[model samples]
Target chain A: EAGVTQSPTHLIKTRGQQATLRCSPISGHTSVYWYQQALGLGLQFLLWYDEGEERNRGNFPPRFSGRQFPNYSSELNVNALELEDSALYLCASSLAAGQGKPLHFGNGTRLTVT
Target chain B: GESVGLHLPTLSVQEGDNSIINCAYSNSASDYFIWYKQESGKGPQFIIDIRSNMDKRQGQRVTVLLNKTVKHLSLQIAATQPGDSAVYFCADYLTGFQKLVFGTGTRLLVSP
Candidate 1:
């Protein structure tokens, strides 16, 4: 079984621009989660998509949004990106949301907002 | 305004020694807790997890202890190795919610 996979291992965007990151969950996983890991900070939950619907989101602003596709892949979009948005964007997959199962994470897309 | 935080910014231990990282959570209602290991430039990896109903849970060489009374959590790594040098984060699942609250994380350094 392949693990979670993320696109654009590294990305660079200017301030006020938009950044889009992608993720592909494990073969049989149905839930995809997005997290932001800023430098010197912990992983902050961004969004959770299950069954093609967003089940939950974190305290982040509306600028941070994402969607899950029919195939269980996910895309995280950051609009009006700020310098603080430079961080590692992680994607994880679980059997389902809140099922108390361990999440498998991808290497993450390192976004650098200039 | 609610969150989880680490008591220490960093921890240094000798190889073959045991290491313990501590975390404090503000949400008393959090029922599920997880410990994750994140390597440099990589994503966070699941180390282990424990539920509110259990006080202690053990993995191969890792152990998680949860103290619901004080809303404290700890991860103990036995015989720490060089590969264990990374950041450890403790995440708490809100009661009846799927969102996970994560801590600031602690950097573990195992010196040979």
Candidate 2:
């Protein structure tokens, strides 16, 4: 089975612009998670969607939002992007929600804010 | 508030040696923990995980140890190699949610 896959391996945007990243979960996975990994920083949880509903989010601002489709694929949107937004946005998938399953991650979309 | 944190910023170990990374969590309610290895410019890869009910879990050349009593977790790599060099993060599963809180991460540098 294919692991989690992310589109736009690399993206570039100017400050104040918007950026969208996509992720496709593995087959049979129902939960998709978004995380941000900044330079010299750890993975920061962004959002969690399962069964087509937003289940949870991290301390990030509302500008960082995303949704999961019926097929379990997910899209992460960053609005009013700042220079600090330049980082690797990772997408992970699990078997289901609230089951403590290990997450399978995508290589990630490297977003560069100019 | 719940937080997972690492005890070291970086660890340097000689090749063929064993490396241990430590993490401490603030939430006793957390029952699941995971270790992730992230290479530069790449996403984190799952190493291994251990639930609160178990003290240890082994996979390949990696092992994860959990001590719920002290809310501590550790990852040990046997016969570490250069390919094992990366930033390792410890994550704790939040109950009732699909979220996992990750620690700051520890940079593992294998010196040949």
Candidate 3:
């Protein structure tokens, strides 16, 4: 079976610019998750989308936003990017929020802000 | 903020030896605890998971032990191999919370 897939394996942006990352969940998964893995840091939750709605969010600023499509794919948009925003943005999917199932992750999009 | 964390940043072991990576979580309300293995340039892969009601779960060559009493979690790999060298992370979540809190991770190195 195909796993979660991410687009533009690498992204380079400048401060004040905007960057968008995309993710396609597994064939049957309905919940999508976005996480940020900074240098020497753990994975920080970004957003959660389920059933085409924004179900939950992290502590990040409003500049970090995303949406889930009808097909369960997701897109993360970071506006007014800063140097500290450079990190590996990961996307994951699973059965659902209440299922307590393991999440399948994409290799991730490496975003480097200058 | 309270979150899951590892006891060590790195661990070195010899091939054929048993390896144990430990983690501590502060969220007693978390209903699910999981372990992930991440290799260089790759996303984390699910190693195993255990529900709060259960104390242990075992997979192919991995075992996860949850000690709710002390709010601790541990992953054990038997007969560790060089391929097992990677960053292992422990994460916890509460059902319906919609967020998985991951630890800083422990880099396990296996020498053949």
Best by DockQ: 3
Assess each prediction's global lDDT (C-alpha) against the native.
0.88, 0.89, 0.91
Judge the docking of candidate 1 as incorrect, acceptable, medium or high: medium
lDDT of 1 at A16: 100
Between candidates 1 and 2, the one scoring higher on TM-score is 2
TM-score of model 3's chain A: 0.97
What lDDT is obtained when candidate 1 is compared to the true structure? Answer: 0.88
Candidate 3 chain A, poorest ten consecutive residues by summed lDDT: A95-104
DockQ of all candidate complexes: 0.51, 0.52, 0.54
Native contact share for candidate 2: 0.59
Please name the candidate that would achieve the greatest TM-score relative to the true structure.
3
**Can you give the lDDT of residue B84 in candidate 3?**
100
- Superior candidate under TM-score, 1 versus 3: 3
lDDT of 3 by residue, A8-69 (tens): 89999999999999999999999999999886668999899989999999999999999999
- DockQ rank order: 3, 2, 1
Residue-level lDDT tens digits of model 1 in A1-114? 788999999999999999999999998889998988776667788899999999998889999998999999999999999999998899999987774777889999999989
lDDT of 1 by residue, B1-112 (tens): 2223334488999999999999999888888888989898788889999989999999999999999999899999999999999988898888667877788888899999
Q: What level of docking quality does candidate 2 show?
A: medium
Ranking by lDDT: 3, 2, 1
